[model samples]
Target: MSAEGEQYGSSEEEDMYSDDGQEMEEDEQGEAPAAQAQPVLGPKEWVGLASMPAATQQALLNALGKLRGRNVNEMTVIFIGKQGVGKSSTVNTLLNERVAPSSPFQPENVRPLLAGRMAAGFTLNVLDTPGLLEGDSVSARGLMALRAALNGRKVDAFVFTDRLDTWRVDNADRAIFTALAENFGAELWERTILGFSHAQTTPTDGKPYEQFVAARVEQYRAAVRSTLGMKNLALPYVLIENGSRCKTNGDGEKVVNDKPWVTDMVSTMVDVASVGEGYEYDHSKAGKKLDPNNKHKIWILPLFLIQVFVLRPLLIGQIKRDVKKAESKAKGKK
Candidate 1:
């Protein structure tokens, strides 16, 4: 038996590379490549997934249901920032539930949850990570966890939650951004959306979103554009207030009760998820027909795995390590 066959058994190995010959033929003939086959969600796979708690499974299923027909297999969003930036609250708002614990003085609260979803099909799983602060020591375990969680996962988008009310460009933010670029590649900024949460705290008298962007065009727009090298790096920021949604007037006016910022944030997420080409499914047939471009099929499977297995765990580990380190330092001081 071949070396791979010895590891996975001959049958499994055969199944894994079953399409190798066909792929080679298409490549040699200069024919358009066939759509990659979907990973069979078999009994073993389901059982492995079922190891997660029932609640997690249900949450994942709910998220999946919301994404059905979008041709998305999985999506993961991680919230990173210093404590008190409302990362937990932002996650709760996104999931429409208080799944993540939040507190005022508690700089670090809960370990990352598989916040939104945990299953097969299309789902958005969120990770609420510990705050990365300037001059703070980050644990290797935390870094490992983050790396593992992100491995093989297709990040639809990332939200960098910063408190603009106390906006100071900090080393922690820079460090985290640098680490993300190193691990995930520089293109991550293109897939990232900066969420300046606690925007309601910003005095309404200062300036509107567009005006603010215009005023600090260099700091806000140009800096990010030049650093990320993406012309469209000007991300939208939202003002979020607990217990109330911002509303807007119909005539393109900001209503007193309008949460246009919140709406914009949500809309941006939808837009990101909607990007990349989509496949047309022909329901008339016994099985759905995949796109000839094979883009969707090729990307979705690995994306799903990364979100479920890698990103969530890594974020959680990072949070836990940070929390423990904070506790240790506190004890030492006492």
Candidate 2:
């Protein structure tokens, strides 16, 4: 079977797949589930679809077809990470076009941008967001921009990007993960695809490539689990190399760790979408407790009532009693 003709499931990810977002059922006699009904998706002219490698285009089609079979007609994936981590590059690479602006010297603006494409009645919307971190902290402006950009759209999945070549996961990593969970809710992890960009780098420590990748993945997994307090969190990850010099297989598709990352990414996305849940962003719900204008406002009236109606009367009575006692003491002295 050809690369796309065969099922595109990654052998390395088979174990992770069963644990990550897939839901299954068993009959009374424990018979295998029947095949899903593959609904027809009307073909639309996606601008970059035809330009991608034949294998990549076929893999994408298969993934989208799986979604259509499960009655999902649209998929919205948002890419988010710190500055210069290749979020925009991943977006461009996945869509097979430069739909997003990615420049090493030029930083993305605080505002996020959403780009959409259509093929075979399946709509794919990708939101490329600004860097969520500013120096060591989460950027408030970026969070506000992301919330506004989403504009209450239902996000089917999130691709959280980071550098696979980074040597360590520090407090900054934990802070970003916590900030996302706080602003977007812990449910975001349920549909998250951890995209470790710059996957084509060699380890400086002289370790084997696969071993280095595993260690890096574990570092992120530990950080997310520790910071979010979700010990059982199963974070599915995909390695991505978006550079022009990335190595390609015989099919002219980008390969990392001997697997075509584009196909793996799309297949993983389809799995997450099949989990039957999408994150609904509510502008009113996010950052309310942290917003100074709204935080503690409800307690303002109650605090004022306690000060005036409760404390003032007691204070006045105590003063009057002190005055009478002073007068009585004066009389006794006389």
Candidate 3:
């Protein structure tokens, strides 16, 4: 597969594309309308939601669930991704505010930022984490802070991010997935959903956008399955198009996200929490070195330190530096 676009096999059923083909047929000028403010669910409305139609009810439920405090219960979710993949931007969008720091120049290395907002019967506790680097594992001390934030609540879902236009899975990506599997166990994959940044826009690749997206999704799915050595498994996914790129679609419309993507994101998290019966926060495995006695390999200690302490930090610094330089060059030329 090409470095720019990771290719994967096959296709599947309906996704976000099927619903907006007609709307996308027209190119809108300027930014898409900002998301409309969500209404708070009063006790009466909360009680009334049950009687509304399925779609409307779910939509409202998702909205109220995100609002910070309204006597609602909470579901905690951790956002995981390599740095600069729009994790912070997505988090800001979710909170309808700039709660998370984000910029195009570089990834934020800040510690995990946790906050809880409650409405009706839903409480959403979002933990925005530092980007995952190969061999860069969480410290036991960091996990302690995370567990303390939970107040004993289970982490319902682990949201992993990628660009919608990314078409290939690299070796580094595979390693990150393997680390996650080992830390959370093979079961965490069950509660995972591939959250795509820039969900509304697609890059031109000599083919239709939808076709490209389908292929990319498959490639990502295959990568995860292969990492886990499982041939028959599909990861849950959601797409949120949040970017500055203005592009043309076959529909002749400039790609713009009006808010459905965010709605879907919240709803999906709720579903995972409900399904998993709540994923508890467990960091006992943090800072774990490779087993020295594993039949899989011998002499893993020095290798572990090199991976975690030496190589990982160097890679992280170089990436951020490159991103900043690229952004600076683009600005100067413009």
Candidate 4:
């Protein structure tokens, strides 16, 4: 079979026609295939469909010929981490625009905010959260606000941001991961991607990427993985150096190298952001099916009428009765 033909087949057939088909067959029958056996479609292929014009839907179908895999739908990416970690910068880069503000905020300190847009008919929302250790008294309130913002929303993936140079095995990072797991459930860990920003801070020794990941500056990576019960604990992560500097010549013309880490980091962000394929966003359905317009609005009309006509009067009467009871109790106590 041709390569295109094989692309449209089951795993068994896809492997059977390949160079290591025999090995895959044996592994399938006796033991599970290695984790690396199944090739993950690259980030480019995943996002290609969404980037295509919707008017080309028929042409896309004919050219691709019955896509065997999933489709990208409404995706939400939440950036959670410490202060000054470039969460907003990463978000702006992924969006390829300045949709998110990057400058720091004071007073109450930087807090989480939600920004959304519709791209290629897919509604994409990215939530930028405040640092885990912003204030002492606002922890519970911050958590509640985070929950409220995420309420009635289906999160497809989370981008956990941390600083490679400033990371530490501290309570703040631990609390952040704990709160994340508690709120989103541990399953979200699998969908999580650790983004280590400020890679330029590392020494210019030109070491391998693997060595950088091994240094364990803060253990944020390991801590989050362990919290999620991941056995390997390495977890997939990306390193980025977002800050840039430029030098000017006599003519006041400036040249830039940008940040070397930016390329790889952007690639990884694209991958993490692309995971929302095949998932729909319908807040009314508890994350099932696309809501599409105000179709669900009709279902609430009768309930609203009942509340207005019957429940409201009953609720008022109950409030009056409770107030009388409280007054009687106060008198008896006196």
* Top lDDT hit: 2
Q: Which lDDT tens digits does candidate 3 get at residues 1-334?
A: 0111111111122110111000101013211111221212211112223333455445646554544343336566778878778887776656544456676664463345554544455656666666665254433322222223333346778788988867678877887677666655666677788998866654676767667777888889999998889776657788776554534344322233433565577778766766636665354543342221133455588789899999999999999999999999999999
Pairs with steric clashes in candidate 2? none
Deviation in Å, model 2, residue 281 alpha carbon: 2.0
Ranking by lDDT: 2, 3, 4, 1
The full ranking of all candidates by TM-score, starting with the best, is 2, 3, 1, 4
lDDT of each: 0.48, 0.72, 0.56, 0.49
Instruction: Give the per-residue lDDT digits (tens) of candidate 2, residues 1-334.
Output: 1111111122321211111112122224322122321212222246677888899899899988998998888888888888899987787777776655677776464455555668878888777777877777677656654554454467888888899998788887787787677776788887888899999999999999999999999888888898899988878999999988999999988999889998899898888878877888654456453222244479999999999999999999999999999999999999
* Model 4 lowest lDDT segment of ten: 1-10
Give per-residue CA lDDT, model 4, range 284-315, as digits (tens): 32221111223457879899999999999999
Off by over 4 Å in 3: 1-72, 105-107, 134-152, 244-259, 281-287, 290-334
Q: What is the clash count for each candidate, in the order shown?
A: 13, 0, 15, 1
Q: Cα deviation in Å at residue 215, candidate 1?
A: 4.2
Worst 10 residues of 2 by lDDT: 1-10
TM-score of 3: 0.59
Model 4 score (lDDT): 0.49
Cα error, residue 11 of model 3, in Å, equals 50
RMSD of 2: 13.7
